[model samples]
Target: MFYFSICFMFFIILFLMSFFLFILSIIFLMMDMVYFFEWELVSLNSSSIVMTFLFDWISLLFMSFVLLISSVVIYYSKEYMSEDFNINRFIMLVLMFVFSMMLLIISPNLISILLGWDGLGLVSYCLVIYFQNVKSYNAGMLTALSNRIGDIALLLAIAWMLNYGSWNYIFYLEISKNHMEMMIIGGLVMLAAMTKSAQIPFSAWLPAAMAAPTPVSALVHSSTLVTAGVYLLIRFNFLLVDSILGKILLLISGLTMFMAGLGANYEFDLKKIIALSTLSQLGLMMSILSMGFLKLALFHLLTHALFKALLFMCAGSIIHNMKNNQDIRLMGNLVTQMPLTSSCFNLANLALCGMPFLAGFYSKDLILEIVMLSYMNLFSFFLYFFSTGLTVCYSFRLIYYTLSGNYMGSSFHLMSDESWVMLSGKFVLLFMSIIGGSLLSWMIFPISTMICLPFYLKMLTLMVCIVGGVMGYTISLVSLMYFNKTLNLYKMSFFLGLMWFMPLISTVGILNPFLFLGNFVFKSFDQGWSEYFGGQVLYKNLKFNSLMMQMFQFNNLKIYLMSLVLWLIILISLLMI
Candidate 1:
């Protein structure tokens, strides 16, 4: 009873906090209306400390997703986390993540922005190891280490900028003019964003991060932390919109989406599959972000929060009832027994697969459309098509396998549907996923049309969405017939090979050479030091000199000083040129 009351009290506090923060967000959103509402450029004095929420309607929309996901994760935790784990500590870390993210959303200065950015990374590291086991500990360390490399790159970029004597963001309003510095800052910042967002070379940490609870996986990976990198880049669009590096980012993002989607389809571990899917979705957002589709990125971020969270939480519910079995192959025909859980999972998957009327359909299609509209080149169009096809292949892999596979697990009674709290949390997201299209088309675009890019520019983006969805769905169903081989090499062979190679290459390329050379140098120095001064003989000789000096030190200091002056002049004159 006491514990239950504590849980209740915790949520009450969260409710109040989020409500307060939301009100503040609204105020900040309106504070710079002239600058944000009008297309014309505006500047404030450097001395002015007024906060300016600079991101367009898109950023505000993403912030809404962050709040919704955070709230749901907190509510879901009551049932998700075991009592043995410190629930209060987890809750505290989660709140900190939310608070920091909100700060990142509204911060006007680079320093404040970095504070929020670093805070989220730290909180995520803590949450990753909330289980406090050896494996989780190692995973958390690696994630932190990888992100640290990106953080350092970001710091170097900031340092480069600050050296130019501009602390206000107004300086970057004309980023293209300073192409050299912009290239350096933009490249380094993109590297940081890629690492945080888990793009290639840094993508492996995400799958390992599933050591965290399902709720954390769902919340952090799907909606908030992973999407942060994309959010950061979008916020800085003025600098990147026409840069050479921006084009490279677009290409890399498309490849990442395709590769991650392929990886997700091949994965068998339930959490890991979802983890890869999270990466794939993040890649999709990044690809659009690279093309300057801020609205599409924000929309995808929002819809992804709903469906992906629902999918993960539902997976947790399945794992919870199945004694924590994580391999999807071990269980089947879950829909027959766990109807409510199955239904929710299916609905979420439908949204994920971009079925008509679902939230993902609109947001993801919008992104593709934007990319196509923004880039008329054949390379851009082909990349979008290929990535879209891959997205379909993976989304249906989950749908077909989970729903249509044979029932094989032991007969176990289903837990009741998610608690009223969890259900209500998802209910809000589900509603958003459904109505988000009309909202975007009718309201958000119209409002931001004046200040942002025009509405007619979005037409190509909308057309691509509709066309891509149909093509992707049709291709996936047809491709399944020819892909009946049971090798599953992508997971068993390729994934394992990549996993093994990371540490293996790190050791050979970095650690081994350093260890071998360092050991040889240390041994040589130790032997030389021993020969010269390591024994009692050396100590006795030093003692004898000290005794003689004490006994017969008649103006020795004067003689030494004379010799030192002579040596100094000879050394100075030799090098004077």
Candidate 2:
């Protein structure tokens, strides 16, 4: 517990240092200076494994933001986990996660990046299971194995990089752009990113990971684990530009966004709802990156990190006051009972919905405008706008259920915003969520965006927001009526509620066949054929040989005499011939 305080101080210092470095990096970017440092640790014939670090606006700025969020999370956890006996373990795991994120950010070599990537997967599993419960254990396994798929993909990528005789993939991005090996590596990298970012088939784990502690949820879902994929794509954007694989990524990301948005609408758990929103935002980032808008994706990634982390913290505070109850249906009128938390939550929700000039507005608006400006297929355009509307719909539904609806829980339960430490973290993030987008857009995108679109297309985002918000509110008002009327589309509702059966696909679809095959092999080989041929047959043969030897030994005289007579007869016959 004492060490927890030390960990908090350490992160605070790290945040300050990273913030200072971010300013310097911005100056360097402005001056058109690229800073790279490399040291060759081992060299072979035409091959070298080098330790490399890259300092650019992207890495530095992202690192700074990561450290900022981490510091706040640590401080917030001090209060959130105050009553827990294993606070030290929790804080340490978070610090380790932060270190891995920093390593992933700085490394230019794929081999080196794996150290950080695997570290994140490992530490996140630890954090997810911090509560030591059945639910947390299962969630941890799902999270770990899902991320293991990405780790394997990265390993495949590293193996393929051997063809270039170098592990520093950054140097080969342009040279191997047209090469088959690079294409294979690019596809594998995208798959790896998909798993890490919870895209499509890998999407179920993100929402399930809400079984973790809220601070861990904030860190893992907001920036550290999930966004690692987006950061990887941003670094590899040079190689992905105009590639066929990029288009595939665009399609997958669009689907992921839509799936998550729909799932969030069906979800009742407050934390899970926020988790789904993070998934949706991650999809948005990946889609934008796939379209070659690296800067825009990065901008959204940072701003989303700010608001999403803040959002999770606010959710944590509310959950804490509500005695660990997270069902949105059980909560209501929190705006009056817990004014500070409700305000922060509402503000973060608005930011998430891309309202006006909030942090989400700048990046999401730019992304939509860019999508409209570009020549895209109708599917991509429809997915982009539809997912956008879904985001608003879910956000409004969540707000209505948790903040404004009549309080449905027991009145004896005490709810208040008394934890200053928790509120302190939210306050810091609240300020950022409000202004972080405009500030980052200014710093990251110095030039004004050139947009020329029809009037309806330009107002598409606003219109969707309005329509979605109205629908969300209206549906919430009459939700009981619909619930009582018991429709025949229960299967459809179940499918949407379970994230389009992605979890089933990932778990049952993947494991059932293999489990069945394993059972078959075990029964046939271990119990039947292998038992007959290997153990039973060998035992029978050995027993028969032993019986023959025993008979020969017991009846030795008669057997010997007969053998001699036969030998004599055979000898006489040979001599006559």
Measured against the true structure, the TM-scores of the candidates, in listed sequence, are: 0.76, 0.89
Candidate 1 local lDDT, residue 117:
82
Clashing residue pairs in candidate 2 are none
Candidate 2 stretches with Cα past 4 Å from truth are 1-4, 40-49, 486-489, 515-577
Q: Estimate the TM-score for candidate 2.
A: 0.89
- What are the per-residue Cα lDDT tens digits for candidate 2 across 1-577? 5766676687679668868977986887798776789988899997766788988878888888888899888889889888888778787788899999999999988988999999999998988888889988978988888898999999999999989877888889987788888999998989899999999889978988998899999988777999999999998887677889898999999999999999898888999999999999999999989989998999999999999999999999988988899999999999999999999999999999999999999999999999999889999999999999999999999999989968889879888888888998899999999989999888888888679889998899999998999988888777745876535656777889899988888778875676688899999999889999898999999999999888878868988898799999999999999
lDDT of 1 by residue, 1-577 (tens): 4545565676666556655644554554556332332222445764444344444445555566677677777777776774545777777787888888887776545666678889988988998898789989977876787688788887887787775665445456464545677678778888989888988767767777888878788788766778778878876766666667677877777667767766665566888887877877888888777766666676677678778888888888888877788877666667776677777777787777666677787676656555545635787677666666655665566655565556556665554564565565566556666765555445434463322345664454444445555654454445445565534434565654244344344435544677688788777766566656777568889999998787556767777787789899999999995
What is the lDDT, from 0 to 100, of the residue 394 in candidate 1?
58
lDDT of each: 0.69, 0.89
Clash count for candidate 1 is 2
Most accurate candidate by TM-score:
2
